[model samples]
Target: MKGGPVLILGATSGMAREIARSFAACGHPIQLAARNVARLEDDRADLETRHGVAVTLHEFDALDLASHKGFVEGLPALPDIAVCAVGAMGTQEENAANPEKGAMVMRANFEGPASILGHLANAMEARGSGTLVGISSVAGDRGRASNYVYGSAKAGFTAFLSGLRNRLAKTGVHVLTVKPGFVATAMTEGMDLPEKLTADPKEVGHAIRIAVQSQKNVIYIRPVWRLIMAIIKAIPEPIFKKTEI
Candidate 1:
C-alpha cells in the first residue's frame, strides 16, 4: 500500500463507503468503521479484492462517546489520515414533536464526530503528523427552520474543525472542514434537493481525498455551493427568516 492506514468513520454510509473505495484504489489500507460491522463485509471484500489492499472493519457508534478513546487505542496501527463522515439528517417536524430526536441529531452529527476527532487531534498532535477530515454541511452556513437541527450540529462541527486546524497548523497535522451542500445519499433520499447544487457520494469522496492530500483548510464538495452559501449567508436575518428554503 502507498498511503498509511486511513481510518474512515461511518464507513458503511454512502459518502464514507465511496471514500474508502477511492483511497483503497490508490493502494491505501482501509479501516472501515460504523455501527453495523457485519453489514460492511461486502464492501470490505470488494476493496480488498479490487484494490489488493488491506481492509479492516471496526464497529463504531457515534453516539457512544465513551468508547471513542478506547476505539483509537485499539486500532491495530495509528491512522495517518482520518475522515469523519458521521452525520444524521432528521425531520424537523418530527424532531419538533420529539425533542429527543433533535438531541440525537446533534449528538450524531456534531458531538460524536468532535469527540473522536478530538482524540485523534491529541494523538496526531503528539505524533506531529496526520490529516483530519471532517464532513460538515452547507446548512451550517446559516440556520434554516427547514433543517436547523442538522444545520446547527454541522455549524458546531465546522467551528470545531476550524479551531483544531488552527491549533495544529504549527504541527504537521492538518484538519480540513468539508461543507457539502446537498448530496444524493440515503440520508437525503426523501428530500427533493436541487440538481445543480447537489453532488454525488463519489464526488464527495474525490473532494475529501484531494483535500487531505493537499492539506486544504476548507472545501465545498461542488464549487457551486460556495456561491450558493455565500448568497444565503449574505442575506439579512430578518429577510432570510421570512423566506423559506
Candidate 2:
C-alpha cells in the first residue's frame, strides 16, 4: 500500500533531493519546501516523471522563524512523514573568526530546524500520528576542536530531538534522529573525507527511508559512526582537549 504524503524541508540540498526520490519511488506523493521554489521545478518534474507520483513545491526559509507556523499551517495536509534536511556546515576557521558567521551556522543548524520541527510535532501530536525525521550530525555526539561551532549546534538539535521523542512517546507521534557521519555532497566537495567513513547521498537517503519505516528512534547512517562516536565520547576531556583530531 502507498504511504501518506511526505514533506521534505530544505528540499534543494542533494541529500534532501535524494530522500525525496526515495519516497517518490515508493509511490508517496512529495511536497518539497525550500527557499527557492523555482529551482525545484526540475526536481519536481523529474520525480513525477520517474516515479509517476505527484510532486509539489513550496518556498521555505529556515532562518525565517516567524514563518514556520504559517508554513506548517499552509501545507495542503499534514504529512505522514516530515523530514528536516536543513543544515549548513560553515568552515571551522571561518566560523571561529567571525562571530556573525558562527551565529549564522548556529541558527541554521539548530534554531531553524528545531523551530520547524517543533511546529510539525505539535500538529502531528494533535493528529496522533506521523513521523518526524531530523538529520543531525555525528559531530554532535562530542564536540571536537576541528568543528566545535557546528558540532555544538548539532548537539543542541540532537538533544531537542531526544526530548521531543520523550515527550511524544505516548502521543502516537514518532520522532527520528539521523546522524549521517560524513556524506559526500556538494557541501563537502572540497573536504578530505575518508572514503570508508563517507557515504553518498543515495546511501544516506535509502537508510533514512528504512529507518523511518522501521520506526527507529535514532540511527547512525554508518554503524561504525556509533562506535567511533562512542570511543570519542568515552575519552577523558582533559586528554582529549590536548589532542588534535
Candidate 3:
C-alpha cells in the first residue's frame, strides 16, 4: 500500500540506505536525515530517479540533542512513518578502558536515539497518526561479556521503545522494535558472523517494510536470532559468566 512520506534518520548507514530503498520502491516519498547533508546527494538522486519518488535530504545530528526539536520542526511535513537507525557499536575492551568512549557509545545507541524519537513520538501523537520504527539489536536481549557496553545501550533503547509503544497504543501511533542479530553491513564488515545467522542489509530492509505494513510490535530480522537470543537469555548467570560467547 502506498503511504505518505517516510523519514529515515541516520540515512547514510548501509542498513538505512536499504530501508529507504525498500520504502521508496513501495511508492513512499522518502526524507533522508543525517549529520552530513551533502553526503546524501547521490542517494537522493538515485532514489528519485530509480523509484520516481520525491526524496529530500536534511541535516541531523543524533548527539546534538539541542537541535532535535528544531530539526523536526523544520521538516517540510510531519512524516507518516519515522525510522531511527542511529547507533554506535564500539569495541567492548575500548569502551571498558575509556569511560568517555563508553559514555559516547551509550549516548549514541540509547540517549541520542531515544531523545530524537521521543520528539518524533510527541509530534506523531499530537497529529494522532504515525508509525515509529526503532532498529535495535538482539545484543540487548542478553548482555554478553564480550559486548556488554554496546549491548547495555541497546537494552535501554529496547525498553524505551517498549514504553513508548505502550503509551501510544491508544493514540494511533504504532511503535515497532526491530532486533537484528548479525546484519552484514559496514558496521560488521570485518567480523566473522555466522553464515546461518547473518542477514543482508536488503533482507532487513524488506523485513522492516513488511513489519510496518503488518503493524508488528517487535521482530527479529532473522527468526533464528529469536531462538538464539532466548537460549542465551535462559542460561544460568553463574554458568553464562564463566564462558565467552
Q: For candidate 3, lDDT tens digit of each residue in 81-129?
A: 9999999887889999997999999999999999999999999999999
For 89-127, candidate 1 gives per-residue lDDT tens digits of 878898778989999999999999999999999999999
TM-score attained by model 3: 0.99
Q: Which regions of candidate 2 fall more than 4 Å away from where they truly are? A: none
**Cα error, candidate 2, residue 222 (Å):** 0.9
lDDT of 1: 0.90
Name every residue pair that clashes in candidate 1: none
Ten residues in sequence with the least summed lDDT for candidate 2: 1-10
lDDT of each: 0.90, 0.95, 0.95
lDDT of 2 by residue, 1-245 (tens): 58899999999999998999999889999999999899999999999999999888988999999999999999998999999999999899999999899999999999999999999999999999999999999989989989999999999999999999999999999999999999999889989999999999999889999999999999998899999999999999899999898
Q: After superposition, how far is residue 208 of candidate 3 from its true place, in Å?
A: 0.1
lDDT of 2: 0.95
